[model samples]
Structure formats: structure tokens, C-alpha cells
Target chain A: MAAASAERRGPRDTIAVSVRDVGMVFGDVHAVRNASFDLPKGRFLTILGPSGSGKTTLLRMIAGFDAPTSGEIYINDRPVSAVPPHRRAIGMVFQKLALFPHMTAAENVAFPLKMRRHDARAIPEKVERYLELVRLGGYGGRRINELSGGQQQRVAIARALVFEPDLLLLDEPLAALDRKLREEMQLEFRRIQKELGVTTINVTHDQREALVVSDEVIVMEGGLIQQKAEPVQAYRTPANAFVANFIGVTNFIEGVVAARDGASVSVSAHGCTLPGVAVGEALAGGDACAGAVRAEQIRIAPRAETLGNLDTLVEGTVVDAIFEGERIVYEVRVPGLGDQLFRVFDHDPVNHLQFSPGDSVCLGWNARDMHVFKK
Target chain B: MRRSRAAYPWTWRVMDGLESLAARLWPARFEKGLPYLMLAPAVLLVGILVLGLVQIGDSSLRVLDTSTFLMSEDLTLANYQRALTESFFATVAGRSLLGSVIVTIVTLIFAFPYAYLMVRTPSSALRKFLLVALFLPFFIGQVVRAYGWLIILGNQGMVNEALGLVGVPPMRLLYNYPAVLFGLVQYMLPFAVLMLAPALTAIPAELESAASSLGANWLRTFRHVVLPLARPGLVGAGLVVVTLSLTDFAIPAILGGGSQDFIANAIYDQFFRTSDQGMGATLSLMLVAVGSLLVGLVFMLFGAGTLAMTGGRK
Candidate 1:
């Protein structure tokens, strides 16, 4: 158990939440396996994963809704493995928002305070304050169904945070919102989290949301924590192929590592040698590997001379060109790389020459842009 | 068109020809009226019921003449007057009303957990078992079930046999008000559970989790979250159980050993045993009014719950 050690460490570490070797198994299925992490006080963390990636199970365990089959979870230097969810000072916003339809926004916010035995005299004021904080000041009298979708979300947040729990867990509350509302709420969440300085853990499958909202992101797959790092680090230097593929639109070129030079490796794919940066593990000669390159990192031009000075350049025919508002994405098939389609993002779509499908184009990227990992 | 029809099977061609013929007769312009046309059968059935009620009402006002063995030429309020003033009638009416209320409350209390378990149980086998148990009673008619209780709670029954094994003598559990009420509750349990299941299922399981995570213990969660959200189901189930128990005749007839009589049994006794059609008609009209008034009160208090066909909250 992490109890004795956590007690010895005491309040000196400033660790608000410490999950140690937590694992949850449902019958024969391992939902979460040997998950461990320490979240510093006042920091926002997100467990990022695909639908069946055990992110929710991990969050549930930390929130005390679930008892981990093994290991313990500590909240502010106290072991909470045996604590029930209500006894544990944790607030959660559900995926569906789960606002009580019968109660008004203020009443919903006042619920936790009432249940937690807060002072009856101070409850109305506290509920008002939290509702206002969520920017739903005068909307308190409105029933949950009476409010708009975004307003309902604010009410849910206020309700969760009104009791001032030790930690806040968000079980993908914004997943149900439309894209525009979701993005707006993401920034709103970030602002409130910063304003309150509550140690928060959010679970989401939306990669962009994880990157946008969290100070740290823990990526999981197959009930295993694949990578845990700051958002930029997780994005720029993924731990393994799963993290690399999961985070963003990346092209994976299957190959064998020809040689390793410090942090960089040269992978020979289909008789073409591609220079790349090694990720997760060092690659020896003849080790099967895949070099991952981000869509934005690759530059596409009409001809070889048009492509700026780069370490590697390949001539390929444009397969498809998609016009996405801010950027133009072109899928290019490079014969030199064995007809593998390489995606290139044109951020300055207005200034760039838009290449149509079947047009021959030159794609180039720096060697450091490609992350080489063992297959 | 001929080539397309020729490519199809004989069944398909026949169906297509029928569809085209029907379309030709119906036409697209009359589509708006189709829904109302479909409602004709239900409306006609209700119209027939209203006509029957009118005849009953007409008979209810007429006094029965003992010497002639026929209704009097002139209408009167004699039956109503007797029904309102008589202690026997008062006791039966009071008993039915009070018994129905108790049965509704008890049935709802028992059904909430049953319906909740059926909806929320994680194990499919357990859910299936609960569903089967809830529906199995429906297969046996209410009258048959009352008889089953008569056998089970009788002096020489299984329950008394078990009690006798402990040196306790067989008790007179039948022919009492409690026995009738007990029989009614058992008969109403399935209807209550059936009415409640959908309402309970409408409530997302996540809300409970949300409630617990928001610092509500399971008991508090049930009180504050589950109970409030399941109001529709409770109201719906309560309304059904109350009305069904109120009008019930078989349970009181069989289980009460002729001592306990509900409104329906009283109506039956007047129409058959006493040979008073006017009294029977009066009781029948009163029962209809009482049932409607109860249902109306429920709608007024709880907005018709799940039974309200209106689109949800404004």
C-alpha cells in the first residue's frame, strides 16, 4: 500500500493526487493496468485515450467510484482506497452533463453543499458565487431543461465545484457539445481551472481538447498508460508508435533501421533511406521500424527547386487535396517511398499554390521531424 | 417499368402492383388526413363506451320497484341516496378507497426497487431473471393468482404447514381485509413494475454516479437524485396500481371469502344477487367517476407522468 510512504512524505511534496499502481479488472478484461501518477497541486491533467482505452476507469478509480483491484490512490497525502466516492472530497462532471432536470441551476449547485452538510446559512451565497463564477449569474432560477446546452454545462461545473472538493474529476463533460460550443467550453474550463486553482483531472478522447486544456496529458491504450508528459512534449516527441499515431495526423513509413547516429536513425524503406529521430527505444542495425512524420511538418511544392532546402525530398503525385478552412491538406503518393501517401498541411492556404489531384509534386521534411520507433 | 418488374420475383411484382394500386386510390394529396383516418377505430370504440355510459346514467336515475320487479316510470335519486347514507355501502366504499391507497403506496415502494434493479443490474442474467419474474404473473390471470394466494395462505397451505412445524397453530389468514389488500397488491405489482421500468430506464445511470461523486452517499443519492428523477415512474405506477386495485373484484371475491367487498364486488352483488339494476348502474357510474377523478388528480399533481403524450417540459 502507498499509505505509509504517503504519510511519511506528508505535505512537503505539494502533490494533490497520487495514484499508485492502480489497476481495475472486469472479469477477464483488464480495464486499467498498473496505472501510477502524481498530480501536483493546482495543475490540470487529462487522461487522453480512445473509447476503450481505460481512461474513464482510471478516472473513476481516482474519484473513488471504483475500487482498484490492486494498489492505492492517495488524495492530499491520505490513502483513499477504502473511501467511498461521497466520503472522498471529489467532484465530477459526467459525460452527459447529468444536471438534475427537476432542480433549478442554483438548486443543482446547492445540492452538493446540502448533501455534504455545509452550513445552511452560507449555502445560498456559496451556490450563488459558484454559479456566477461559471458565468451563469442570473440564470440560477432557470430549470436545467430551460437553459441552453452551454448553460447546462456551466450549471454542471458549478454543481461539481460548489462544495470545494479536494479534487475535481471531469469525465468528458464537453464530449456531447457541438464543435464550436465544445471549443468555447474548453477555454472556459481552462479559465475556471486557473481561477480556482483546483487540482483537476479530465478524461477525454478528443486529442485537440487534451492538448488545449491540460498542463499534462496521460495517453493510454489497451488498458495501459502509454505516455505521460506535458502537452507539447507529448505532441512533439511521443513515447512510442501508439502515442505518435494517436495524438495527431502522422504518416508512418514502414522500414528497417540502417544505422543509429546518437538520437537520429536512418531507416531504409523500399530501397529508400529516410533519416529520422529515434523515439522510445534506440534502434540497432536491421531493426524493423516505422518513421512517423507530422502532416504539418511536411512541405509540398510543384517541383524540386520550389521545395525549400531540406534533408529529404521525394517526388510524388498528389492523390487528394482537401480544403479545410485554415489549412489545405494534400495527400501525395511518393513512388520513391513505395507509393505510400504522405499528407502535407498548407497552413497559409491563401498564399500557397493549391495543388489538385494527379499533379506531380515534391514533398520534403527535415530529418528531425520524423520520429522512428520499433515496429 | 415492365423491364424492372420483370427483373423481380413474383412476390415482389405482386407486392409492387398492390402498392401502386393502393397509392393510386389513396393519392399523395390525402396523406395529411391519413393519421386522422387511422384514429377512426379508437374514436369509434370510445364513442361506443360513452353511449353505453349514457344508457347506464339513464338507468341509474330510475328507482327499482320491488312489487313489479321493474324500474319505476319516473326517475329518482333513491339509489344514490341509499348508497351515500347506508353504512354497509359507506364501509365498502371507504374500504376500497383506503385499501387502494395503501396498496398503491406499498406497490410503488416495492416496485421502485424492483424496476430499478431490472433496469440497472449489470448482469444480463439477473436482469433477465427480474424481467421474467415481473412478467410471469401477467401470464396467470388476476383471478387465478388470487386463488393461488388462497391455496398458499390457507389453513392447510404451505405457509401454515411451515408455521405448524414450529408448533404454531394454523391461523385464519383468509376472509380478512388484509388478505384482500394483500391479494390486490400482488395483482398490481406487475402493472406497477411494468409502468415504472421505462421511467426508471429513462434516467441515465451516469446521473447516479454524478450524484455520488458530488458528495451524495448511496442513500442520499436515492433520496435526492434517483427518487426525484423517477417521479414520473412513481406517479405512473401509483396511478395504475390505485385505479386497478380500486376497481378490482376477483381478489376480494376469492381471497376475502365473500366477507370483504370492494366497489366492483359491490356493483356485481347489486346487479346479480340483489336483482337491483338501478343500484348497480349507480355504483358503476360512481366507480367510473371516482377512477377518473383519481386519474385527474394524479395528472394535476404530477403532470400525467409518463402517460402524458404531450412533448416534455416547456
Candidate 2:
């Protein structure tokens, strides 16, 4: 298999894909506007967004399916805006998998090799190698409809990578699978991508899939990239309110900045002062601001005195409590913070006492966990 | 299980009354026969057709006595023997068969691209324009369309008049085998396209894009992927066009100038012009047998393309 040789040649630290000021407009609607990003070799970058957020448009442009209206895209520093999709050395697993229903799994895997006119003698060995790469060694002769959905997905992946293209694109191939299979395939894709060290760009609306599979996640909204960062940085330090609201369940506290100290700022809302880390644009005193804190970042205690060694604490009453299998989510309405309701997740439910509705509680979090942004 | 009737809603009571009334009118066993009851009219219509065919079969065995202008009382195979032996009937049958094959091949070749473009075009106006052009001939009768072609293709017609302006002599473009074949093709184009459109539409656009991404160019993609996937539509459209053209009478009657006669034209002459019912009935039965044999051959070779009558396992 070429996989062993591919692994021997480790991934190089060079820019694999570069998009410069790309824009796409269809009649009156601006589908993608002023998008730009660079992905290094052998890294997995996922463009994450909701439907109609231009993520798919951007991916299509990169794949040479759609031409950008404004700027150019480069594969290995060569501008490819004029190249046709067939000529481009890129493999794509479509949103629907797009496996040919008429062909057997082996034929499906052999298509790219046949199209590229690989050596006639080497075709079968290569096909079998890729089928084995996808862990479908003995089942290559089965037609597409005879295979399960997950097996069909493996066929698509193998077919896309059979030619050993310079770059691979995944267009939400797991969006239709059930949750368990989707998660399993996410890990499977990550493993295959790493093993082959193929530069890949995946587009998906599922944020969890993005975080699980991608080395970097690019969050998009309304035809613009809101933030592009590593998964941890994106989850911990979102660039703006959209990224914060889109990535995870976050509670926003609307207030005015009363004090600013380097990276930290104090925001006053409903006559209560709260400390938070200042992110994005600089903030001056009396400037309108919003504080974002993730549900898991905040801890809920039975009393204010019980939660010690925290940066900020506020007393509130539990307005609602939902018991999920792994964790319990509590919605607390703080009286001192503009009567705002904050969600806190209790991960250690067995060790910690569960607070029911109408029970008095205290919500506490570190100042670094709260991201303060200009409203 | 019996529940209190008074406890149920008024709607339930009304439904119950209707159900009991139905039960009294039709026994429960009759429910199983409802589908066959609905099929009775179609079956009766076919039975009547079979009876007429039987009568025709009997009549085709008798010879017409020209002196008395009446069929002979004694049955014989004279009509069939004469039809098989006559050179005129052989020429007509051969012309019809050859012309139908040519027309079907030409029509399918033209209709496939037209149907594909109509189905794949992104512009709604273009698709609507193609659809309107296809159906416009349907609004005009086949005979009228054939005559329209005659006027357009005749010497000193619109085309010849345009040619005259260029200082060229008026050419006889109508009333020939080519003209008859051309008319048949034009008439059958829409039927072929209509039959093929649904099958083409069943192909998802993603498959094309997928093929292109997998390194097949547009032409290769069409040849390898689109063409194979559209086999059922092609076969179905081919069958319809072939049979329709083989039995067609109007195009040859109007465009052939009485020189190129199809099977239906010959049958018409046998029944109406010569008033030979025996010969007409013989020719009619032969036409049916020929069409059915062609269709049967197709089903055997292609396994009912796009009909999907086969088991799921293939």
C-alpha cells in the first residue's frame, strides 16, 4: 500500500492551501464575502457554519466547482481559479457521499485511478490497498446499495483518496449518519487523515464534528468568517459574540465597563460589578459591553460562602434544573445581576448535591473564564 | 369488545353507522375482491378487443370474391398466402421496417441531448421554452404537422423561396423517402424526449459533480456515467418511437407522395381503397405480431429497462 510510503514521508510544515479575499455573489445575494484563510500541509481545517452561511460556497470555490467572484485560491502556491475541477489534484467526499450506485465498491475505489490513467497492471492492487485502507478489504465486490451507510461512507473516502491527490475536501460526509456513527466516523476520518498526512479541508454545520475532527475550526456567520482558531482557543476565547453564541451554550450579561486594567475589565450591570477578561477591541470606561461565560465554566453552590477561592461570585435562585445522563444543567436567576439567568452544568452530580428549582444557590467563575466584548 | 355507544362522540357514532351499513351491503370477504372489481372495466375492454381480433382472424382466412364483391363462405389461407407472396406487400413491409428503424435511431440521438439539456439547464426560462416547443406539436394534430412540413419543404415553398433569393434553382425537397423519414423523426422527437425526461431527472446532479471531482471530464462523465445510468430511459424511448413509427400512416401519406408506404398506409389501402377486408385484417394482425415481437425482444434483452419489475437483488 502507498500508505506506508506516505507515512515514511512525514508531513512538511508548508502552506498547502491559501485563499485570498474570496467572494461569491449569485445575482443579488452575496453567498460568500471576503473570506481568507491559509491551511498548512497535512492539517485538517473545518469551515463550520449554519446553512446559508457561505461555508459550502467557499468550499466549492476551493474545490473548483464554483469560481470566486473576487479573489483567487492557491494550492501549493499555484493560483487555481482558472483550473477545472477534473484537472485539479483534489479529492472530495460529497455531502451525500455520491457513491456510484451502479458500480461495486472496488470499482468505485478504482474510478479515480482509472480516470487518471494509472498503470493498468497496478490498478487492482491499488484498489485493494485503498479498500483495505478504509478497512473494507474483502467486501470490495459488493454493490453500493448492498452496503450499510457507514460502509458506503468508507467507500466514498477510499474513492476520493485513491488517486493520492494533493488535497482532500470533505463536504459534511457524516451529516446524514446517526450520532454514534457520525462520532465514530469523525475519529475515523481524523485517523486516516493523519496516517496518510493528506492536507484536508472539511465543511460542516455541526460544531461538535468540527471540534472533534479539525486541527483548526473556522466559524462563519452571514457570509463572513467570525473566527479562525485552534479548537481549544476557539472554545475558550471566541473572537466576538457570534463565535461565543455559536460554538457552545453561553450566557451573556449586558453591562457597561466600569474599569479596565490591561487584559481584565470590570463590568457593572444591575448595580453589581463583575470582573471579566477583555477580548477583541479595547474598552474604555462607560463603554457598553457584554460578558460571556460558558455553562461548564461556572460552578453552582448551595450558598455563597461555600464557593471559595473564586474570582467572582453572585447569589441566585435555581429557576430550573434538567438532569441529563452525564451531567445536570441548572438555570440560576441571579438577583444581583440584573435578574439574568445563567446556566451552570454540574459534572460531578454524584458527589455534589443536586439543587432543585426555587433553591437558593451561588454561581461562581474565574475572571479569565468570562470573556468581555464590546457590544 | 363492546363499549357504551352513548359514551362515544357523535362522529364515532356516525362512523359506526356507516361501517355497519357497509357491512350489511358488502360482506367482509368482498373487500378482498375490490381491486379486481375496479379492474373489471379494463378487463372487459381488453376482452372485447380480443373478440374483435378473433373475428378478424377468421375473416383473414377467407378470400374476397372480386366479381361478387363479397367474401367467400369457405375459409382458406389465401389472404395470408397472397400477402406473403406479393412483391408489393414485401416492399411496403421492408420500407416500413427500415424507415421505422432509421427514424427511431435518429429521433433518439436528437432527443437525448435535448432531454438532457432541458432537465439539467439551470435557467427556468430556457427549460420552459424547450418544454413549450416540445408540446406545441401535440396541440396540432399529426396530420397537420406533416402537412406543415410538406408546405415548408416543397418546391417553391418557404425554404425554396429563400433559396431562390440566393440565385439557386428550386429543389424538390419533399415527397421522397428522406422527407418521409424526416417527418417521422420530427413527429416522434417529442415522445422520445418525454419518455426520457423522467429517467434523466431521476439522476441526481451530484453524481455528475462527483464524477468530475473523481477526475472524469465532462465528455467521459457523460459517456461512462450518465449514458449507462440513463440506459432504461434510452431503451424505453427507443421502444416507443420504434413501434409508433412502424405503424404510423399520416407522415407517409402526406409526405411520401404515395411512393413510400408504411404498414399502416398499406393496411388503409387494403381496407378503404381496394375494399379488401381480408387483406386488411391479415395486414393488421401481422402489424400487431411484429410490434409485440419487437417489444418482447427488447424486454428479453434489457430486462424491462426503467420499469424496475425485477427483484431487488438484480
Candidate 3:
């Protein structure tokens, strides 16, 4: 109980796996173009992207399954580009879970040991230790197919770790599982990685999975790294329009920065100005800057014009209203900006949501809640 | 009360219930069975061929009087004993087994590399041309191919003529065991390649990389992963080549010079030339049984050994 308390207070160390200008191409098709990042070790770094954003390719190069066409990879301060996967001592749990279909759980765990050509006598014992570590205590003799999806995932982890690899790469390992099981595996993986203190890099396209599991999330799009930062940090402070839109729902309105104040600014859009928006300087403040209003941050019925000692408001015509369980998705048409979507959540009573799809109402937020970026 | 049918038992009620359930089920199952109805003619053809083979087996088991259509004499093991114990027939069987084993092993070694190259190498036209070339020798008349070899390896033939031009005397080359082995391998290489190519294609490219990533280089990967996986196909090819070698007559006849008589040639001699139909039938049955047993043993060893454990209960 005391040790658990200590662990709760203890934070992870800051060792990083640096990928430098790594790119790959099959003939003329560029798979990854100058993909680079300092993936902090001992914390989950998920490169979240759609299929063929070169996410899996990046992971493969890091795992040494494929060598980079052009750059260097350093894990724990060693150049690992030329190193073979087994020699590099990195473990990779494949997307298909690539468990040798014929081998038992013990044999699967013993594979890395076999690859290292360890003493045949010691393989069984080493295998049992890792299997037990993964909480598969008595499943050593069970075949891979005998294990359920989650159990097989744990066995794959055990197999990868049996040799105590320096780095572990998981290439979308939960892509095949159903929703509930995938979420369960995500939590289980986090706990195991923390307990083991092994540096792991996981590649996944599921944004929620990435957000829940990773310490740092690197968002990629169209073969380029869009943003790499902490999960909450990336969510709160997206570096670009792509990062903002890709991470979640945001009402990005094209505008120009018109006036600036101490911690707030005004963005002129579609002939009218949205005043008191925060153009926080991730990008240098310029006149032609774009502004964003997140749907979740938009207030619906709490229209008490409360911005400092004064008030600011913009009127929009409500075009559609969607009941999204606990929240309402309002598709409103601002006077000149055309259509804008805002999500109002369930915090107050139902009578407050007194607008229909065709009704016109004034919507506004605190200047600090809005974000402005370069157009 | 009369409508209730007072004599009806509970078992009858259950049967009626089951009948209704089955009536509901049968149409859907018969709708699925439409596909099998389409296969009926082909299946019947196969059944007829199997029935024919069974009749041949029955005929081999009897004592043929030759004077009667049916077996007028008593059934006998004497034919089988006569076929097995005869020195010439025994020697012929031994020769066929030994020759086929050597030839098949050599064919396997040569064929796997060439087949692997066909799959991995990047040239499509080259692979196609090579595939055509592989069949070219087989496409030529068997007599013509044998005679062509006879010319190449004979004392006064092209090979000896070339050597003689270089001031070397013609060496003896016609009709020998060396000639027979050469002819057998040449004859069976196409068969070996046809078997191996499909197996090589079936091996996923990921497996090769998987092995390589696990630190096994080309040779170790080929041995542990490639070869073991390809064994089923290799064994299948071996059965075909060995059976072909056992049942072969022309290759041995052309090259054996009466010294390397195969079982087929001996069976041929017994059936018509020597007028011993009983011994011939018995010998042919023995060869068939040998091939079947060999194939069955191989399947039991390799195919059955791959019995897999379930992978979901963890």
C-alpha cells in the first residue's frame, strides 16, 4: 500500500527515442517524408493518423523491420538505423498479433530467447517469468489460438519482453479487437508498461485510444508530423488548423486579427467582428490570423453576456439541432460566416435549451476560450 | 373428443412436433443443396473411376485361368509369392526404389533453388520464358529425347566426336546406370519444379522478413521457416516422382541395357512376353501398395504432426 502510494506520486523519467529526418519510399511512392520526433522513452508516444499517413512505416523503421531510406534513428543515444531488429534488441507486437499460430503461449514467449540462441534449458523458465508478469500465470502450455484476443495480446507482450528488449514498438495492436476489449487492453497495456518501465512506442489511428493511452500524442497527416505534444497540451494548444481540426471537433472560422488587447483579441469574420477571442501566441500575432471556437466550449442558454465588466455577442440563425444524448449539436448560420456547429452539453435544466433548428439566437464565449491562428 | 384422437401417444405428439420443425428446416437445406446437385455428374464420374480401380484390385486377387472369363480355378497367394521371390523381379524392385530415391533427392535440391528464383526475381518475361523452357524438354518426343541423349553420351556421338577432335579417344557411354540416372532426373525435374513453385508462392513474404528480423540470416531462415513449411509440397512431389519412377518402362528400357530393369518392364515381360499374367497382376498390385503406403506414411508424419492447439481461452 505504501509502495502504491509512492508510485502514484512518482513521475516517469525523460529518456527519448529520437527519430531524425527518417523517410522511406517504395520505388516512387514516398511512404514517409522526413518524419522526425524525439519520442520520450518510458512514456507512451502514439503517432495517431489515418492509414498510410506513414504511421506504421515510421513504427516499422523504428523497430528495424525496414531501414530508413534517408535518416538516422537513435534510441537511448545509439544509432539504430543499420542494426537488425533482433540485434537492436527491440520488440514489436505486430498488428495481426503475429503470434506463431502453432506455438503455445510459452513457446511464443520463448521466441526472442530462441532468436538470441540462449540456452535451451533456460528458455522455459524465462518464458514462465514474463508470462506470469503479464498475469498469464498458468497459461504457458496453452496454444496461441487457445488464448482470447486480450490474452493473446498479453502473450505477445510477454514474447516481446522475454529477452528484455531495449525498446518496444506496438503497431496498432488493438486494431482487430472490438471496442470494449480495445479499451480494456489500452488500460492493461498502460499498467504493464508502467510496471516494467520499458520504453514503448505505439502507433494507432484511433484518436480516443491514443488520447487515453499516450502521455505524448504526435498527430500526423498526409505524411507530415502535424503536432507532437502532451495529450492535454496538444488538445488545448493545437499548433495549426490541421492539428485543431484533426484532434477533435472545432468551429474554425476564417478571419483576420483586427485588434489586440492584454490577453484577448478581436477577429473580423464575414463583415462582423468576433471580439474578445484569445489569439494566444503559438504563432506570432499577425493581422491575417484565423480564429477557432470549439463546440464544447460554446455556451447555449447561459446567454448572460458576461465578458469582464462588459459584454460581446454575435447573432446566428439556427439551421439544425441534433440531440446527441447528453448534449445538443447546434448547426447555426452566423450572419456572414454561413454555417457553424456548436455543441452544448447537459449541465443545467432542459428548459434552458429553448431554441429550435430554425430559431435565431446570439452565441458568445469568453475571449480566453477562443483561439486564433494564421489563416 | 373424436377429433382429439384418444389413441395418440405422447411419442406421436413429439414426432409430429419434430416433423414440423424438420419440414421448416428442409427447404432451406435443400436450397443450399442445389450446388451439390450441380456437382452430381462430376462426382459420379469419380465414383465410376474408383469402382473401376476396385474391380482391377479384385481381378489382381484372383487366379486367372485365361481359358474362362471368370475365375474357374481357386484363388491363390501363389502368384504373389511367385512375383516376390523370383530373383529377377526382386532385383528389379530394388533397383527401381534405389534409383527413384537418388533421382528424387537430386531433383529436390536442384528444383527448390530454381523455383525460389522464379518467385523472388523481378523479371516477369524471364520467369515466363524459363517456365516454357522447363517444359520444352518434356514437350519433345520421349523417343527423340532418349535418342538425342544417346547421341550426346554415346562413344561415337557428338560428345565423343568433340573429345576425339581434341585428340582424345572415344569413351564408352551408351546404355548404363549413369545414363539411366541422368535420364531419370531430366525426366522428373519438370515434375519437381511444378510442385515446388506453388509451395514457394504460398509462403508469405512476411515470414521471410519475420525470420530475418528474428536474426536468422538467409540460410537459417530458409531452413527453419521456409523448408519446414514447404515440406508438404516437397513430400507430395516425392511421392509423384517415386511412383513415376516405379511405374516407368521406356527410360529404363532405353538406358538400363537389360541390367537396370524396372518393375514396370518386368511386369510387361510377365504379362505378355513371358505369358505369366498372374505374376504380372500380383507384381503391379505390390507396386501400387508400396506407393500408397509410402504416401500414407509421409502424410501421417508431416501433415498429422501439425495438430494445432486452440488459441483463445487465455
Which candidate has the highest DockQ of all? 1
Whole-model lDDT for model 1 versus the true structure?
0.89
Place model 3 in a CAPRI quality band: incorrect
Q: In order, what lDDT does every prediction score?
A: 0.89, 0.91, 0.75
| Candidates 1 and 3, the one with greater DockQ | 1
- lDDT score, candidate 3, position B130: 77
Count of backbone collisions in candidate 1 = 0
- Kindly report the docking quality category of candidate 2: medium
TM, every model = 0.94, 0.93, 0.79
Candidate 2: residue A160 Cα off by (Å): 0.4
Tens digits of per-residue lDDT, candidate 3, A304-350, equal 35322323456677777777656667777766565555444434456
Q: How far off is residue A233 in model 2, in Å?
A: 0.9
CA deviation > 4 Å runs, candidate 3: A1-16, A119-121, A259-265, A275-289, A302-330, A333-335, A340-362, B1-78, B110-204, B207-224, B249-259, B272-276, B304-314
- Cα lDDT tens digits, model 3, B160-272, are 99999999999878677778888888888888888778767766766566555555677777776788767656876777777777677888888776677888888788777
Clashing pairs in 1: none
TM-score: which is higher, 2 or 3? 2
Question: CA shift at A156, candidate 3, in angstroms?
Answer: 0.7
List DockQ, one per candidate, in order: 0.72, 0.60, 0.20
